[model samples]
Target: MSKEITSRKDDYSQWYNDLIIKGGLADYSAVRGCMVIKPYGYALWENMRDVLDKMFKDTGHQNAYFPLFVPKSLFEKEEENAEGFAKECAVVTHYRLKVNPDKKGALMVDPESKLEEELIIRPTSEAIIWNTYKGWIQSYRDLPLLINQWANVVRWEMRTRLFLRTAEFLWQEGHTAHATAEEAVAETKQMLEVYADFAETYMAMPVIKGVKSANERFAGALDTYCIEAMMQDGKALQAGTSHFLGQNFAKAFDVKFSDKENKLDYVWATSWGVSTRLIGALVMAHSDDDGLILPPKLAPIQVVIVPIFKGEEQKKAIDEKVSVLVKELKQAGVKVKYDDSDNARPGWKFAEYELKGVPLRIGIGARDIQNNVVEVARRDTREKKSYPMEGLADSLVNLLNDIQQSIYNKAFNFREEHITPAETWDEFVKLLDEKAGFISAHWDGTGETEDKIKELTKATIRCIPLNNTKEEGKCILTGQPSNQRVLFARAY
Candidate 1:
């Protein structure tokens, strides 16, 4: 029954690692920079994936998978992208491995099995996907190709964390093609909004919708739109990103479409994605020292019914009541679990459910049943109240909705209070070091200045918020003329 989690205040990093392992989310794998997502963790990811899949379908995007390996030639087609990911690319040179002739029981790459051309495990799907698009598009009729792929990608990260950064991770990358730059830009912005909506509504994590500066923009993209969320440790997490490729991939792969006038033009393109790192974001944003605090909408088990009983007769009565309650709750479209197993005591089950971040817990006992009441516990506020069982299902639904909004509001308020505005260099550094949230400051609009600030403070510009007001002010670092302010923070 002990909550053996590291205190967040003492060490945020250890707290995160402890919560992931102790809460049964994920564990370190034999691979250097990869993780084994346990069933409980995978279940959470599945719920997130199902919701995002439905959202993409509703937005005119169809799910179609692409190859995981890209030929070296096709991958290097886009020079900027190739150079950007060159450091992290994992290449396959030999196709087969054989037992060593000299060293018994040891496997070695067979010299005769060398491939004609090397292959690049996909870091992103732009190159291979655009190569395929070359054959798919011929006329203006194929104007917009809204395609999304749910797949795993490799990026050979040296410094790895459970769900945050790993060598290989699962993600959904959306690659779309358009006939016009305008349409492609619109699509990029649309997907950004979708991501923001999902983060705020489903994950109960508030985010700021913004555009990345040139230095922070994605490789081969003209503009990168992103949603940034502030974690409990006062750091920024890039929750999701949408890139406006602006025909970079199209031109590289010779993906052209003939207009009605018979003139061929390079097709415009966009790519946006959200990875399992979001699971880390959710944990950091609202989780307490006790354990995770998953939002109701995203939790695999929204409500868990834990029955309290004594002997055979009381246990039978509690089991019967739990069955009826479970049926009623499921009928009302609620994800509920009846944990009647006696492997653990009631107290142990309560602690386990809390660690798992189940939004609500209902404890029904023989005494409560006789009194026509049940004890309901809220994870977010850690509040418990007894209510009659007559209209329990409906009341629980409403309570879940309230908890969702409450969690969002709490995160929103934290972000609001933490964004400190700085007008001078001294103030910027002081706020970044002392108060560690977001620094809203004017920049000289140069990558050199941004790089200098990052070098000094370890804080980068999180984003230049979309629709940010244009005000005449001096750059906080350079004392040069500036128009609008950008957000800066140390990020994950």
Candidate 2:
């Protein structure tokens, strides 16, 4: 299985595809530009989703579902948002399909059953959600409505990757209503912090907390806050985003509420989301050429124990010891699996679990058990050590925590090394091509300059770092006066 994977040094793109396909994560689906996340991948997602869902609840948010299709009129309520997604929107015009008369066994859209109004599959849920909010909010008592939905969205992308840019993918979108602009902005920043924390703590991937420039902001948004992460290939990925929509959606949908002062005004709004694309980020950021290097916190199988024995009697002895260890690990709240199947050799099982990115693997044989020790291998470092069976479960608990931090530290160090400063146009271009990571350079703060830079080098301003320092400098391209530098990268 490991031989089937392409080395990252040989081809980064192919390497990613190889891992996703052969590492038991996902497969190309029958649907065009879509993927089928396999059981292993879905289990990983479930672990991630469970952690994030609890974080949302602890932050005073509630889960609620909404309609999958939005009425065309409602979708068009916000002109900028509608125009932004118009090219990708999939419309439903007919309610039913009938068998074609000329071609037997073939189905065709029944013209007579066409609906009076078209429905647009939601690319984002703001339009439909705010329309519903109009009926729900009527007074100051209903000032802040914090809701999140775990569902799938369609964007109809021309090109797609397994977990990165599919036409339809699973995600959790949070739409919120506040009574004032300040409140909405606060919510936006808060969610950005939440995303940054989640990416760093749970995913074990370091991210930069920043705000997007006007040209890159989400459509119909007053401001967009985001977290950016760098992959091992020196490319940046937008991990998550939180947008402050001001009163755009509220005004477009006429969602107004009365304050204590008896004044009626459109509600302020914010929306934020993180999707399965994070799975892509995780794979690219940490995995090696061998296979995936999943973080222990989010890995489906955090620990796997493989037993080695020649005959039934030996197998029974190893099983007895392993059963006790597994029970202890489970009691300690660890996701540990004992792979004692007879179909495969011990070495094959080791490679299979290693390719799957299990954080730690324990190998026990008759001799090792008699010696009162087991061989433990660390997936992140590929280091093996022997430990006594007694108190082994408690030791594994501490080791998992260490592995998580070690992975994050390695990624964080690489990111720190890749960020280089550019002072001139030639320098910026040279750095982008030769270095291929984040280039911090001054900008004239104009859309034309941003567009020209992207056209020239395919690098856009990922974000203006939050709380960025004020400094005197000249724009790298236009040589115009500038106040601060922003991060620029060719991204996914």
Candidate 3:
């Protein structure tokens, strides 16, 4: 199985790269900063996407798609958003490419086909969606247009990883139009809660629900709510974000609706999204040096059964019993696999499944069949146990549930232990020099102070936290009077 992954302790960064490449999750593509997600990895993503799709639908949001390209004029309508993404925007200057006249078999951009107006590949969909909303809304009845789009966006990132950051990536963006500021704000907070719930419940990763600092807010948003999770290395990852756009987009695009009083006003807006970067977060938070530690709820294969038999006479008997057990497990709503092929040894399959992070593994043999029992192994704690075949399916289901909880508990404990607080500038610098996980320290609540701290430490304020307690103290950096503490960490 060649499970030669680098030790996380030796080099966390290389360890992550080794896991992604050798674990069969993804591979580098011909493109410099893009990757090809393997079937194993794509299956993981499909499971995550399925759960999130249902969650969005249950919350009264409908899926609808918009254009991938935004006209340069429309994108510039919102000054802040345009300026924020301008550096990463990919532009289409010409319509077609022609064979080079000077060099045969080479293609060149056709100057004659240059477009009158350039189309910008969307870094985010806010500009194009809001422009279309101008035509979709005519009255109050059209308010609260809850639309979600599942698509890929390009950000032109210079440094790229398999899933964390790339030149292009897949994500779901929710852009909604609201009738009032209160509703928009409420929607933003609600989505943040949904993201936090999904992260903790399905990903088996705990997160901090908080409000982004002004300097950290979304480009055109008045307020940005986020769920931040800590990886095993003590770095923060922004799992998801929901922004209260306040009337900025609506005013920029002139999307107005008439109220019951017959007065017209701009619509309130919100945008929230979670990307495939989440896959990276899940891997970093749990997995060991051997392989991935996928949560049962999101694992494509929950349980896999491997047969340990010598010959056809013994294998046939074991197969008969294993087939029935497989059906029972599936009927019980378990994702189970029975590996009956002779192409590889049971040892190889075991290592492979362990590397894939299958929640549970079952081994059945001729003697075990005669004894009416099978051996089961738990991936999280690597504990092995024997159970009777009579109710093995039911017992395995319960075991999977426990594994999910156990993973979350371990991660939560790690996160709690890493969150260190510092009162003075010297202590803050020392703590961040170690960069255990998070630094909760008082800030003067000014962008200048935030920028200075980041410049000196390369650690930005992750968030202010929701419902944060107020306390009088001096700022860690400026020594100015402060009221509340903010979370500081180097983030992905």
Q: Which sequence of candidate numbers ranks them by lDDT, best first?
A: 1, 2, 3
Clashes by residue pair, model 2: none
Q: Give the Cα lDDT of each candidate.
A: 0.94, 0.93, 0.93
Put down candidate 3 lDDT per residue, 1-492, tens digits, no spaces. 386988999999899998888778899999988899999899999999999999999999999999999999999999998998999989988999999999989999998999999999999999999999999998999978999999999998878888999899999999999999999999999899889999999999999999999999889999999999999999999999999999999889999999999899999999999999999999999999888888999998999999999989999998899889988998999999999889999999999999888989999888798899999999999999999998898899999999999999999999999999899999999998876899999999999999999999889999988978999999998899999999999888
Off by over 4 Å in 2: 1-3
Q: What is the Å distance of residue 349 in model 3 from its true position?
A: 0.9
Scored by Cα lDDT, where does model 2 land? 0.93
lDDT, model 3, position 59: 93
Q: Which ten residues in a row have the lowest lDDT in candidate 1?
A: 1-10
TM-scores of the models, in the given order? Answer: 0.99, 0.99, 0.98
* lDDT string, candidate 2, 134-229, tens digits: 999999799799999999999998889889999999999999999999999999999999999999998899999999999899999999999999
- Give Cα distance to truth, residue 260, candidate 3, Å: 0.3
User: What is the overall TM-score of model 2 with all chains considered together?
Assistant: 0.99
lDDT of 3: 0.93
If candidate 3 were superposed on the true structure by all CA atoms, what would the RMSD be?
A: 1.0
